[model samples]
Target: MTNDELQQLAAGLANCGKALLRMADVLMEKKEDAPAAAEQKEPEKKLTLEDVRRVAADKARQGHMEEVRQLIQKFGADKLSGVDAARYPAMMKELEAMGNDE
Candidate 1:
């Protein structure tokens, strides 16, 4: 092949390499973002009084009754039932964490 033809072919190949690299970068970015997008799309499970009660019961059974009562009182409730429904998620989180402390 002529020198000029070979140079032109080299430049074309380099351009194609750059294009491929850009495509790879885009695909990688999308892959990295996929999990975050999925997490954002997935709705948080709604916490219920019963769910909180179940966890609290487990903690109590494990002999954390006093700790459970303090956690409930921290939310300004004397008992689990007295705590507002809106606070169930936070209450459950604390109850679950109580077991992890061990």
Candidate 2:
């Protein structure tokens, strides 16, 4: 191969390497920005009224009525279904913790 052709190929490779380095920098910036954006975002919950009731019914059917009643009383609700939406996640977590204990 001619020297001029080799020099052109070398230049092209250097340009490609610089382009890759710039792309890497852009990705690193996005990674740093992600946590800040995520912190500003409220965690999304997937629970529904039906889901709460269903999880409670499962508890009852499994002979966990005492635990269920305790949760209901703790939350000042008549039944699992009566628990407020905001408290449902906590309620479920308590129930889960109970299940985990045994």
How do the residues 3-87 of candidate 1 rate in per-residue lDDT, one tens digit apiece? 9999999999999999999999999999999998888766778988888999898889999999999999999999889999988
Point to the candidate with the largest TM-score: 2
Clashing pairs in 1: none
Clashing pairs in 2: none
Q: What's the C-alpha lDDT at position 16 in model 2? A: 100
lDDT of 1 at 87: 82
For model 2, residues 36-83, the per-residue Cα lDDT tens digits are 998896876678888777777788788888988988889988876677
Q: Give me the displacement of residue 64 in model 1, in angstroms.
A: 0.3
List candidate 1 segments past 4 Å from native: 1-39
TM-score of each: 0.60, 0.67
State each model's C-alpha RMSD to the native.
Answer: 5.4, 2.8
Candidate 2: residue 7 Cα off by (Å): 1.9
lDDT of 2: 0.84
